[model samples]
Target: LSTTTDNGTTALHFASVGDASVVLSYLTELSTLKEINQQNYYGETPLHWASFTSLAHVKILLKNGADPTIKDSKNNTPLHLAAQAGNSDVVRFLLEQKLVDANAENSCGDTALRVACEEKEL
Candidate 1:
């Protein structure tokens, strides 16, 4: 159930990037919620991609137990990616999660707020 592509991207990642809500639901049903947080070669979880792709995808992943605090290879959480990508809704949603660390920094020592500021998303 943890099958992935060459880069370690699982079906959930594809579904999230494509915003295929039905496919996502089906995949979730076929697999366990733990699969929802599968990471790619770069350590980017489905949530990381979803944060910049679709809000619905993010919501589905979160509801299925995806950890918002999970970091990628660069040490950037889903919230950091969302902020860096200027996804205000994703950022806001992530901030609402109790596990989300708003002050969490990436490998570069940049927080979500700093990323948002650097990206001129403020």
Candidate 2:
């Protein structure tokens, strides 16, 4: 279950990136919290990828102990990715949870709102 790809992408990372809810559920259930929150070579957690997908993916990730506040190599949180992807529902869900730091800045010193405005039409 802890196996990863050449770049350190785990099963959980693939599942989250593909928005495979069923696989995510199974993997999260079978994996430990550390495994669920495992960072790839780029320092991104499964939750980070999930944020760029759907709210369903984000929900499953969070419910299964994926840390939303974790930063990637670029210092971007899950919320940062979600906002940049124009996923308002995912962003809203994450904001409501309050686990993520809404005020977090990435390596470029851009907040999620700044990323949102710059990346999306919002």
Candidate 3:
């Protein structure tokens, strides 16, 4: 149970941040995988958090049928967050799924690829 009452965080949020296998498995049994993609107070989905951290949860959630193209309140998708975090693993993973909108811009009008270029020396 979350100590914060208003955050309304789902098991997916924590799972995406890192290795939350135990909780994730439990939640999977209780709820549908699509429910894991639901948002929290910050309007971030599980895929968003997972990609941001370059965690295996990204793959886990993906395999469980999570949508990679969903966006947050800032109009940033999981791919955008992954690029900003410079997580090559997550970026590659997202690319392989072919769900990312390469031309998709954030609230700032920058694409995820653009954000990646800004963060990486390449």
Q: Which candidate is the best by TM-score?
A: 2
Write model 2 residue lDDT over 1-122, tens digit each, in one string: 89999899898888887745898888899999999999999999989988887789888878888888889999999999989889899989888878888898999999999999998734
Q: Lowest-scoring 10 consecutive residues by lDDT in candidate 2?
A: 15-24
Q: Look at candidate 2 and tell me the lDDT of residue 47.
A: 91
Q: Which sequence of candidate numbers ranks them by lDDT, best first?
A: 2, 1, 3
Candidate 2 segments exceeding 4 Å error: none
Q: What is the Cα-based TM-score of model 3?
A: 0.83
TM-score against truth, every candidate? 0.91, 0.95, 0.83
- Report the C-alpha lDDT of model 3 over 1-122, residue by residue, as the tens digit: 23233686765577567556666656545657557667777778778888877556777777777788788889999988888988888888777768787789999999988998988822
Query: What local distance difference test score does each model get?
Result: 0.85, 0.88, 0.75
How much is 75 displaced in model 3, in angstroms? 0.4
Give lDDT tens digits, candidate 1, residues 18-118: 84688877777776767877888999988899898688888888778888888999999988988989999888877776559899989999999999999
